[model samples]
Target: MISRISALIAAVACAATLAVSPLVAHAQDQQASAASAAPAEQTAAPVAEAAAPAAAAATEKKDNPYSLGNIIAHGNTVDQAVLVILAIMSMGSWYILFIRLWDTAKLNKEAKEVRASFFKKASLQEGLKSLSETGAFRYIAQTGVDASEHHEGALTENIDHNTWVTMNIDRAVGEVNSRLQGGLGFLATVGSTSPFIGLFGTVWGILQALTQIGVAGQASIDKVAGPVGAALIMTAIGLAVAVPAVLGYNWLVNRNKAVMSQVRAFAADLHGVLMGNRKVAGR
Candidate 1:
């Protein structure tokens, strides 16, 4: 586009030079004047070329009131660093959320399978056989049965069969709960701290904007409003980063509880079966 403008300007200069050539009264002076006009046109084109970017940039700002491009472009290193940090936090929060959701879904599916199949078996061995070897319920059932059978060992001399089995099953349940709870703390941290990080960005932005206002020696509303409002975007972005992390943390924690409830229910029933001496004898 600049090239086209330059070409058109050069053409206009040539035309004007041609039209004025007859009025010069001397050939050499006319030549000199034409040469001077050529340099002037060349200089003007460069000036216009330089100014195009500035005008376009201003237009862009006017086109978008809260211009992210302008913010990044004009923002100092600290401002940019804050933006980068918030972006990373947002991304990490989402990644953790996805991972936790997948883990929770797998647990829920296994629980549903347990509900459908594990309890319906005719005996402890049958139930344990029916469960998937990799599943949480299967692990608890196997651990219980193992404890029930290991009651004669020297380690079992002090602990009663019931207590030992309960301890083993409880331990298994706790481990399962731990697995369910793995990524929630990061989510909580993100939620609790992201807004403050964003607020820091907001504060930094306002400070810089105000500093700029001071440098220019003006307290006019437009100057103050534009930069201050743009600075406030940092706070808005921080909230955007923090909200999903918080909500996801609460939701995933609750879902973990639901999964754990199913685990506890199975553990309780397994405990009853173990306490009844279901596997103590040959059968």
Candidate 2:
């Protein structure tokens, strides 16, 4: 009976050991699963944060404002160098236009006054005095009289007199022509070079655009449009400045030609008066 009791006790102990072993193994499995999943959760957190910024950036990119109106309104569009060139061209054009207009008008009025004074019974000395009130026409008439006074002689005795008079007349006319051509050459130069200067700005802007694309790692419209639009603004400004300069140059040139024609006619009329119809061989 004692042996039977001992065997039963041993069997009970063995059953308890087997049940406790399974419980401990289940707890270890749960711990292992939690440890493994912890690393995965930590890794996913950073990925989610990184993805969030990218999504926000994409949204912002969609709302980019590089339009013409936006650029103009902001006054953030044009390059400074391009702006300077445009301003210079514009101011120069207006300056030339105003200066030449006044100069031409004065010249015309003075010439008409000189003609009237001569026709209204002014002697040579009186006519010169009347012309002397204005410098431009005065210089012209004085040049002819000076030339005639310097070369006073008979035709056979003074062969060089005609040549001297012609030279002095040409010199005075050339001086007047120089005044007429003033500022026009600069206008032409501005017209010719403005496009090239703007083209340089455009190229520089394109280079900047490429740099931005490289940094952003994508070539979206937002990434490219800003620089391109800014670049085009420079080009357009250049053309806007250039067109007026070119037109001004052409207009001034034609007006100069007209003024020079009047000068030549005045010189011829003076030559006829001073030398007489028979004395002046080439009327």
Candidate 3:
């Protein structure tokens, strides 16, 4: 009976060990699967982090409607007209600036040529020949010569030779000054008024924005700020248009003064030449 009981206990212990081995193997398999999944999760976390910011940026760009392209595309008729006027004013201002700058440069170049070539000649007739046909210097020289030669004319018979020639030469210088002053008024107008034009656009935009916001009854920051902010861009653009025009106007005015001074000096020298056989100052 004791031997039979010992055999039965051995059989039960073997069955328990067999059941426990499968559970241990299953636990180890699960632990290995978890370890592999952890590495994959670590790699995926960095990729997800990078993708999140990119997705956010795309959403922001999609939501925002204040880009220049959008302003032009989605703008109302008044907004479009204001933009057009500002554009035209800006373009016209630059065009006038460039053209006036070119004119100033030509005047300066002619002044130099007069000093080098016209003043070096021995006689007034030879000096006149040295100047350009269309140049300010030649015009002055011809006016003085014509006045000296035609002293008997009804317009100038009462005036003496010296006085008549001087008057003609001075008038020529004044004409040159008038020519130099051309287009400067436009620049002044643009500079003084462009900011107001832009402000007009901004104010109109604000009015529209407010009207819409009032009708919608959505006074929240997101709703109010976006349209108002977009409206302010018109003011910025107006200022941008105005600043260069103002600066260019000032610069051209100063340069014009310098040019006119040189012209007056040349006129004085020419007057002396007509009256006497005086040597030109620079030569």
Report clash pairs, candidate 2. none
Runs in model 2 deviating more than 4 A are 1-78, 152-159, 277-283
Go through the candidates in order and give the C-alpha RMSD of each one to the true structure: 14.8, 15.8, 7.1
lDDT of 3 by residue, 1-283 (tens): 9999999999999999999999999999999999999999999999999999999987784734776666788877877887898899899899988988888899899999988888788778898888889988889889988886778868668787778888888899899888888888988999999899999988887887788789889877756665676679889999999999999999999999999899999999888877774233325
How close is every model to the real structure, measured as TM-score?
0.70, 0.66, 0.73
TM-score of 2: 0.66
User: How many pairs of residues collide in model 2?
Assistant: 0
| Tens digit of per-residue lDDT, candidate 1, span 1-283 | 9999999999999999998887765887878999999999999999999999999987783644456676788766877888899889899889989988887888888888888887787788888888888978888899988988877767677897678889999999999898878878888888999899888878876786688789889877766665676678888888999999999999998888888898899899889977776555636
As for lDDT, the candidate ahead, 1 or 3, is 3
TM-score of 3: 0.73
lDDT of 2: 0.78
Q: Give the worst 10-residue stretch by lDDT in candidate 1.
A: 61-70
| Model 3 regions lying over 4 Å from their true place | 1-64, 277-283
lDDT digits (tens) for residues 50-107 of candidate 2: 9999999877845336554444455333466556667777898879978987888788
CA-lDDT, candidates in order:
0.84, 0.78, 0.86
